[model samples]
Target chain A: MSNQMFHTSKSFDQDLTETTDLFLEMGALAGQQVAQAMHALIEGDMHLAHQVVEQDSAVNQLEVLIDERILLLVAKRQPAARDLRYVMAVSKGVVDIERIGDEAAKIAHMAQQVAADNSGTYSYHEVQHLSNQVRLMLHSALAAFEHLQVERAFDVMRSDGNVDFEYQSAMRALMTYVMEDPRQVSHVINLMWILRALERIGDHARNIAELVIYISSGTDVRHSDFETVQQAIDASKIG
Target chain B: MSNQMFHTSKSFDQDLTETTDLFLEMGALAGQQVAQAMHALIEGDMHLAHQVVEQDSAVNQLEVLIDERILLLVAKRQPAARDLRYVMAVSKGVVDIERIGDEAAKIAHMAQQVAADNSGTYSYHEVQHLSNQVRLMLHSALAAFEHLQVERAFDVMRSDGNVDFEYQSAMRALMTYVMEDPRQVSHVINLMWILRALERIGDHARNIAELVIYISSGTDVRHSDFETVQQAIDASKIG
Candidate 1:
């Protein structure tokens, strides 16, 4: 009887591993959608913007699928201890990814709006810089998840501050443009909204990175001082 | 040795239960603060607003306490299946509560701004009405949590639509007030910001309710149709 129980448990573990891999694939797809949205905005490619919007539905579907799978696993497999933590982390991580997809769609919508203006009134350069920063953060954070690399996750979290700063700078520049020529305020405000959405994408990436650190180290790094997270990351590298 | 292990597990479960009770108490306190913030806004009472802001530190401290306890429980107890789900839900619930506290403080700050105006030009009626609606939602949502009443949670989610409608109406009224009298646009805009914050609070409450359903039923009620959550709630009651 004991040997039979052991075999059953081993099979359960294997099934969970397979489920986790599927979740990671979904995360990769969501990350690619975000990057593509940014690229579309930078290139003023309306077709690519539409593609990002279209892809969001798939990401949303994946979120629901992963959520259902996690719930079923908990009910059936009764994962304990470390496996429990891993499942819960993936559940929350997918939420962050789904929100990132929403933010990307929001950016794409902004791109469409800019395209409709037909006035060539708004420049995409500032938005391009903001998108690049956010995309890099998303990529690094997802990579951290793939490797469970605590230090890389920490780097992603720290990068969020820079993205936010760039967003603020972009906002100020846009404000100045609006103030100088009030006629352009409407178009520029739309661009500002896109920049804000990109900034929010970075925030969601930071959330995922925080989750990664928590899942790997069993620590609640949120609300901790930056220095503490950094120190924890360094310690994790050695320990 | 088997007996000793059983005793240890029982003791750990008792500790976890106690920790969860404390978390619930903190949640109730946070809800009260949110209600008082709305009251302060409606009454134009800066003293009460300041009190709410000062008390926010307590809410923040409780959030950290809850996080620490959750981490400790997961590490020590290695709770399986349903117990693990409950722990994860509690952690996420505390986060929603913390955000609600932040929103209350934001409302208090807005109240302070309105009080500072001294213009005596802006009528507080619409703001009062909007605050009342938000307070009703907050109160109902907390009651649902306290009772574990799924129907009450569903009610809270549905109430969000009303709150949002009132908020948009308030916005429209404020915009008209500003356009009709350009001199007051700045003050009206500030008031609009406060209204938006209150609407966001309602959104957070809905989030908590969705989480409650998920915790109880292992269902991902989010992104699903309203009827689905309602049906889940009904099924849980029957079971």
Candidate 2:
């Protein structure tokens, strides 16, 4: 994250910097895919949804490229201590970004399915709200990662609680719709799947934020902050 | 997996062997948690379900320990070529194993919720079958990993299709049940969550099998096998 974290070799530093930049670019693309999928879902635009699906290949390709770069960087340079941790975290964290891309593509596929069905009875307001929360979560997490902002990373982690709350609300609302009209069961289930993917995207974003924290502080902060935030999230949900 | 895959470095070999053993133990425990969660759902065994939930901590701890070991081994030994690939695969593969643990814990939580409801009218035969398929899939994948059997790994990847099919069938059946009587919507939804976790467990297993093939043959087998297998899985769902 910071410029001076490792100083053993200049090439290793450049490789690390380039790899992180590629990961950020991939993260940004994934965020766009999630947004575009939601746009297509909301506006009933199958064309954009198809584009989102097609774009996922680029994200996957980036992951493979990042992996190859990491393998070369680690094998050739042999980073020690903090430098090694940074490479390891980036290699692992990029997978989360790739999976976030998968989730986005899944949302787009559901959009395509709904578009094919040609049903205009549903508005998908809940999905739109939750996915916006998810996008913000991922965006902030990526910012924390790019800048190595520990405070921002914690903020992103705290924001994940709100995103999860939105996800559960969306699921509950979809369940209510299905219960109201059994004929809409299929429609509601499709939206439910989209919501599930969006919720998971938020979770993955939180994982990335945790990675930033791990890299910055050299301490794993997984369950530490989340539980307190989760308790608050749950209490807010109940109240 | 072969004897001569990596050059003879006794301590690196020992570290690799020990790290892999930890991963296998984590995988097996995740498999058991999944199975026990289903058993608790079927038999209404709240005690076993609670145990499954509690046991997830051990799995998490194993992942952390394995990660620490991996970081140390990679930094100290600086393994090259095949050895480096093996370490990378194991490091990434272990995360899948950890996620499998999360899915199992999720299933157990759903079991706990259903058990507290104390309703005996619902039989989870479909879920039982699907979770069993998932367990076997993961079990085979881990065995393939431990023995470095490329053929067996391929078989595990192929078997993921059946698990996906079973997952769709279970979802369809649950949808029908909920549509038939909306009063049982909550019950059906709970079972649906369990099935979703089982489906993801299968997906994770397939990812691990991919890792096994990657380590064994020195080639990434993801897009190669999954595209072909996914089509069959999708076709089976329709027909």
Candidate 3:
């Protein structure tokens, strides 16, 4: 945000800083959960998966807190355009982070489901590959958000297509696996659910990236075409 | 909202009403799109399916409008507790409705894919059943949200379990069909995607129902046990 956009109220500035800190902390926690949830699944550690599930409540609480703070801040300060955009992006970004937490819990739940019965173990190389890609995407996206870097957000957005491609390929390969061996249907289905959750996390990261770009450039890059976003990225002013 | 909650300015009430009116219209339009998307798939009418995808932008625009009005109202009037909760619920409610529209578009996109290669005609009875169930859920959920009917929202929540059961059954059946004839893998996959989309729509409707209860009771019923929600529904102040 620009210096001119900052209000004179000391409390307002402090509250904004506190909220941004909370949001970043929440995002980092959620990213850790995503990684740990995948680890629990790959290791077949039900205890760790349950821990991930239990930790989701904390993420939920943070979302509620962040949203309440945002509404309060907007009502009290009535900041200028840049600050308003920042507030809006953070408010919207919290939801995606919360959703990512939910997705992590979903991955954990799927892990528990697969372990419920002594069934065949589904392969995880592709899932791990996709998870790593999204985890990195999320990490970079969060950094971009922190620094208000629109170009970094564009890079995150570009990486998402590869995640999509990986997801579809994994889904098709899983479908083929089940078709080849009828008995593997249940096992493969559980794995597919995990893949779907990971794919959704990637989408949420992309959403946060778009919001980051919006806050930085005052542009709605969400539903715009690739060429439009690319041109905006090319012509963007700040780092 | 209570009389005390209303601002002295007449435009406050007018803007609130306008926002609510826009939300209800968007919900109704999305419900219609979901119905039409299912119809397109069952009848192999790619035209209607494509129409659903193309028309999603309008629903999206309504969300943007509702959100903007909400922020403006909060910044201008700073509504009291009761009105604040109502505004927050409505703001969050629009996200679920917009997501429902995206799911409808997803169903339409899947329909277009299945139609691209007419290898087989997927069964429609279960698909229609789940589609009808979720459409009704969205309809009733939206009504409950409009009227703040906690009991009706509870009823909507109860129906979602049946949708989940049916989705699982349909997935199992689809898997068996693909196993029986590998040539039908692509066709079965498309049907599975449609089922998944419908299932997700049901989930979104359930989320909206929970929000309705929250707005009415000022209680966070989300993620609460069904028994707890049921008790709250029984003891709720309003219908």
> Which candidate wins on lDDT?
3
Chain B superposition TM-score per model: 0.86, 0.90, 0.94
Ranking by TM-score: 2, 3, 1
Best by TM-score: 2
Supply every candidate's count of residue pairs whose N, Cα or C atoms clash at under 3 angstroms. 0, 0, 0
Score chain A of model 2 by TM-score against the reference chain A. Answer: 0.90
Docking class of 1: incorrect
Best DockQ goes to which candidate?
Answer: 2
Best-to-worst lDDT order = 3, 2, 1
* Model 3 Cα lDDT, one tens digit per residue, B164-210: 99999998888778667767766876788789999999998998999
lDDT of 3 by residue, A1-239 (tens): 22233567878888888888899999999999999999998888999999999999999888878877876777567665668778877877887899999999999998898888558655788999999999999999998888878788998999999999999999988877877776676677778878989999999999899988777666677777789887776656644
For all candidates in order, state the fraction of native interface contacts they contain: 0.08, 0.56, 0.10
Q: What is the TM-score of chain B in candidate 3?
A: 0.94
What is the model-wide C-alpha lDDT for candidate 1?
Answer: 0.73
Which regions in candidate 1 have their CA more than 4 angstroms from the true location?
A1-16, A36-57, A72-84, A109-120, A183-185, B1-19, B29-61, B71-85, B104-129, B169-195
Instruction: Give the Å shift of residue B34 in candidate 1.
Output: 4.6
lDDT by residue (tens digit), candidate 1, B11-105: 77676666667667777777788778877876879999999999987887887787667656766666655566567767767766777787788
TM-score of predicted structure 3, chain A: 0.94
Q: lDDT of all the models against the reference?
A: 0.73, 0.81, 0.84
Compared with the true structure, what per-residue lDDT tens digits does model 2 show for residues A1-239?
45356576777778889988888999999999899989988888989999999999998888878888898899998988768878898888888998999999999999888888665366778888888888988999988888877667778888888887888887888778777776776677788889899989988999898887677566656656566444443443354
